[model samples]
Target: MSEPLDPGPFFHGTKADLQIGDLLTAGFRSNYRPEVVMNHIYFTALRDGAGLAAEIAAGDGEPRVYVVEPTGSFEDDPNVTDKKFPGNPTRSYRSVHPIRIVGEVHDWTRLTPEALQQWRDRLATIAQERGEIIN
Candidate 1:
């Protein structure tokens, strides 16, 4: 078999308060598309990327980044890899199986208010245009 694309100390981002050993699973509504339930749980190798995800996640709770370990096979997130960005520069991946929370990260960069507004504006535009989330 081919080697894994990344040897990640993988991270998942969200607003949910979770404990160490908590399991993040699939079947949640898409953060980008609330109408659809996600079949895969996504994570990234980049801490800041996860932070961005947490910042934009659909909730009012505090954003959080969790160090995670995938419980099964994962693949490059098709929503970004070779689609919006070429070749998984984001180092994002998704798995059908659950990912366990090992610990929390406290030092990821948080976006400024203006920057956060810009991102929200971008997401609103995408939603208005009905952006395709590659499930």
Candidate 2:
């Protein structure tokens, strides 16, 4: 008789297709971290996140593409004026800027050209929308 199918991985393929085998799947899956903000949106979109992350890594085993976290405060309101008091500071908020390798880019730049361009174009669009200079 043919050998039995190798029943494997505790949780299969990206919860489905990506789950090829247990050992491999394990590397690809993890429990959501409690410290995660954004309501763990990143965790919920694991497949897409992983794909993007893989693209970012560019096979160099380094995360090339990353959803970067902004520091301190952002330029959320570039219009914030000094017309406010001390407690009422007018700090701009930039949220976060998802970046792909520019100076130190990842190899995935080639794999997902469309995505990278989309990101660039999106920023351009936002800049245009905000009447910001796009040079």
Candidate 3:
């Protein structure tokens, strides 16, 4: 039998208050444990006229989803955080092109794609198993 995958994420909070950037930050900080390098990194959002509205008009810090591939530090550490959403949201940053990183949010993200995928796959399996997703 194959070894079990890690339990991905529980999402302790609600999406009601969560925004796009919230998801990103939280995803990055998810792998935090004892005696780790903490990944020692930062992100710079891609700025273009397309996705600037939501970011600018955000009450304080609104979230805009985006399609982000491993940009930086992806090569440095195998743990460079990357998240994938099959059911892309309408409000997500356009094509993941014009991106923007919200100023200093919470240190709330994880660093394991395998675990993330495991959880995502499991959740979908459960939802499909229960017919939560309509065909």
Candidate 4:
């Protein structure tokens, strides 16, 4: 077997309120493209990256970042790794299996309103341009 890509105390970000032991599974809609039902659940080793995902996740609920443990093997996310940012600098991964919520983190840095708006505007532009999600 191949060696694992990352030894992560991984994190998943979302706007959903969740408790410890909750299982985050694949088949959810993509946060970036609602039209796509994701085949894999994505996570990252970088806490701040997860924080950014949580902030931009599509929902009315408050953003949350959860410490998660993958229930099965995972691989580097092709969407960002090599495809966009080379060398997996984002430390992102995706799993077809579920990831269990081990705990919640409360101290992640929040984006400023302007920064958030900038991200929103960027996403909007991508959507308008019909960017592919590499699902």
* Top candidate, metric lDDT: 1
lDDT tens per residue, model 3, 1-135:
543122211112111243344333222221122222232322223222113322322244433323232222211112222233343222222111222223323333432557546755665575456532110
Better of 1 and 4 by TM-score: 1
**Candidate 4 runs further than 4 Å off:** none
lDDT of 1 by residue, 1-135 (tens): 989879999999999999999999999999888998999999999999999999999989999999999999999999879867779999999999999999999999999999988998998897788568888
Model 4 lDDT per residue over 32-112, tens place? 989999999999999989999999999999999999999999988988888767799989999999999999998888999
- C-alpha lDDT of all candidate models, in order: 0.94, 0.28, 0.28, 0.92
> Cα RMSD (Å) per model?
1.1, 18.5, 16.2, 1.3
Error of 2 at 9 (Å): 14
Per-residue lDDT of candidate 2, residues 80-126 (tens digit): 22322332132222223221211222232243688756755664575
Better model by TM-score: candidate 1 vs candidate 3: 1
What are the TM-scores, per candidate, against the unseen true structure? 0.95, 0.21, 0.23, 0.94
Find the 10 residues in a row with the least total lDDT in model 4. 126-135
Worst 10 residues of 3 by lDDT: 6-15
Better of 1 and 3 by lDDT: 1
Residue runs of model 1 more than 4 Å from their true location after superposition = none
For lDDT, candidate 2 versus 3, the one ahead is 3
Candidate 2 Cα misplacement greater than 4 A, ranges: 1-42, 53-61, 64-111, 127-135
